[model samples]
Target: MLSTRRRQFVNMLIFLLLILFILYSSILARFRTPEVALDSSSGSFLTKTYLGLENEQAQSELISGSSLHNEGQFVSGNPQSSLSSLSSSSNEPETINKVSTAGVPSDDVNNRNHISAEISSERSVLKSEKKNEVEEELHRILSISPVVIFSKTRCPFSVRAKNILLKKYSIDPAPHIVELDQHPLGSSLQKSLAALTGRSSVPNVFISGQSIGGCDEVIDLDQKNILATKIYELGKQSIKVQLRQTT
Candidate 1:
């Protein structure tokens, strides 16, 4: 039952109260309380104390510093002390004047030199003795044979040389024929004989304890007609001696 003008005035007052309420709420949301940080000097002091404790612990681990009666601890300042202690624990100390198992004095260089010289002289003597033994064996082989021929079974040159003595001269050189390829010691003996006689080739021909070269020399002597005369003289002497003994 309120008049129109009175109603309008009431509506305006209510609108104004609602706007003021919204403005107050927005301002309150924008304005925040400031956060306080810890003091820098206090934090730094705490950090230094922690680092000092850690350093003391490291020093104590590396070296035992103080007297047993006193509780005070000392820190090692030398950097090499830990390394030196590790090395000493690992290896036993050795003296420079220690002697060896061979009874040689390790302290003197002259003793080592003398031992080396003696070892070398012994090796030289052993080598010389071996050489002399080989020489004696070779000498025996050469001195026992008046005619020696080293040949191979399958070699054409060996067959040709044998044929010249047997068929042409009618001389049986079987006892003097050395088949080098068939014998076990033949190769080594042939090499030694060849080395001593200064003949580097094989199918060697030696007559009257002399090396007459190879097949070519024998063929040359046959072509010269001297081979037949020599064989005839050897055969005649043998036959004559045999006839006299039988009579």
Candidate 2:
């Protein structure tokens, strides 16, 4: 009987130990962290550098600045200009495109360039005096009228803009129309207009020598019923200026 009791106790202890071992293994598995092996060459998970974004230089500067800030050092002044600069830089391509397009007149303009602006002596300039004469002639032309339309006769947009201004609304001191396509210095003038107005297209309408933009802009103003009001208000201001000058 004593021998039987010893065997039974040994068996109970072994069973208990086996149960404990199983429980410990299961608990360990539930709490265990799996190791992940990242393969950079495979282009899978973990080490793609572009994940930081394409603006790596910007990011590095930001990180470096943050570190400097943490260290209580002078980082940078007016970082706000960074965004403004980026915006302006992004618009550079459009400005270049405008200059290029204005430098070369349209197909119709190439042939009609001998038609002349008011048939004035300023039609042609000597190469030696070209730049100064161009500026001076443009200034003279702008002062001829309170409202001016730099137009290309064959351009549909130009025609539309003229129709809107001439027929739809009655403007005082009648707009001076410079058929740019007919002018000798047309391309130069167009390019200058691009520089001045940020628009390379014809039908560049000006009030008091300020460009209001091309056809689409005119249409937008018309749609809003502000075109007449704008013209009248600008004309009124021009009159006031003249009166002030006379006084």
Candidate 3:
């Protein structure tokens, strides 16, 4: 009976040892390296996905950078076009000045030339009228007598010259004494005489509308005794002309 009891005890101890061994194996299998292998595979998949995403982002950044560069080129073209327009605008006035100088006369310049021509013509007309008036006056003075004397009232030389021609010679159709200082158109007549006969002094003596010069010349001619003979001959000629006109 004791031997059977010992065998039974041994069998019970072996069965208990087998149950503990089975329990330990099941616990170890529940937390094993297979799970670690699955985690490793999943981590590898995640790393590949991350790498792909980074590559795509880099490509997008490159594309965006290229687009920005193209946009910058487009933006820069606007300033060039504006500069071209400014250059064209600045050249417009220069072209206009060139055109004006070439042969297309400016209106203002033409107007100025026309005005200058008109002024010159007007001056010419006025000068011609003045000359005609002066000539008419000269003819009237000469027709007064054959012998004419231009004299000044205040000049002693003119008085002496008149005395020599009138009192000493006793000339017929006696010299017409003109007092220039007392006359209204005296200065004008003197200037005209200077222009016509080259004589402008007092006692400018004339015989038959011819200048004989001033006081000293007349006295000299009288002292030489030729003045009385010249006067008598001119007087006879004047009387003959008057008689012929009367007939």
Candidate 4:
């Protein structure tokens, strides 16, 4: 019976050891860290070297007061303008003065003056052409009537002259009156008339395309009794011309 007990105890110990081994293996499996797979894709040395060089260049350009932002390429010098150097040195007064004058040379100034004079001459020509057009229009109006008066509707002198010429005299074909105040080319006509007759004021009377002067002169001629004679003679002439045209 003692021998049988000893073998049974040995078998129990072996069974216990087998159970402990299984428990340890299960615990190790639960807490074990998994291994990760790594890729073999390291970049080449040349690419790393080029990236390092570009970073160094960008840093250098930033320190030199310039940047690669403008053209996406680094520039060598500071991005400041040379014009600001005008106030720097006292010995460069002539250069400073040149810069002060907008850096334009003396020859360029002379050329500009010449161009300005040419433009002034062109403007003068245009004015003269406009004046000629006004004169031609005035002449056309005068040709249609035996008598023409360059007068302003608002002028008392013009009213006075109209009254005398149209009311006092029994002239045929009443005088053609241009009320400059109401005309579109009124100011231009006045300028043309002044240039032609040398009489700048209104009430500029024209008899048979001839200037009979202003209101003062017309009244003077009437007081002398020659104004009526001149008007009737011109009226007779116009009547004869009309009669001939009809025939």
Off by over 4 Å in 2: 1-128, 238-247
Q: Over the full model, what C-alpha lDDT does candidate 3 score relative to the true structure?
A: 0.74
Residues 183-204, candidate 3, lDDT per residue (tens digit)? Answer: 7778788888998778878889
Clashing residue pairs in candidate 3 are: none
Cα lDDT tens digits for candidate 1, 154-230: 88877787777655554433326777787666666677667867775667766545566777766787788776555
Error of 2 at 201 (Å): 1.2
- Residue-level lDDT of model 2, residues 1-247, one tens digit each, is 5698899999999999999999998997776323211333465444344443434667777776555455344444347755675567668644322323456545435445645543444644455378777787789889999898999989999999988887777666788999998999888888888888899889899988888888998899999988877776877654322111122
Instruction: Report model 3's TM-score to 2 decimal places.
Output: 0.50
TM-score to true structure, per model: 0.42, 0.45, 0.50, 0.49
| Candidate with more favorable, higher lDDT: 1 or 4 | 4
- Ranked by TM-score, the better of candidates 1 and 4 is 4
Please identify model 1 stretches exceeding 4 Å from their true place. Answer: 1-145, 170-175, 224-247
The C-alpha lDDT values of all candidates are: 0.62, 0.74, 0.74, 0.74
lDDT of 4 by residue, 1-247 (tens): 5699899999999999999999998997676322111111344566556666776787776677554546354444643543343235445535422422566776677779999999999999998898778878897889877888889878999999988877666556667889998988888888888888898899998878778799999899888878866765666655321111222
Native-structure RMSD, model 2:
25.9
**In angstroms, what RMSD does candidate 1 have relative to the true structure?**
16.9
Better of 1 and 2 by lDDT: 2
In candidate 3, residue 148 scores what lDDT? Answer: 89
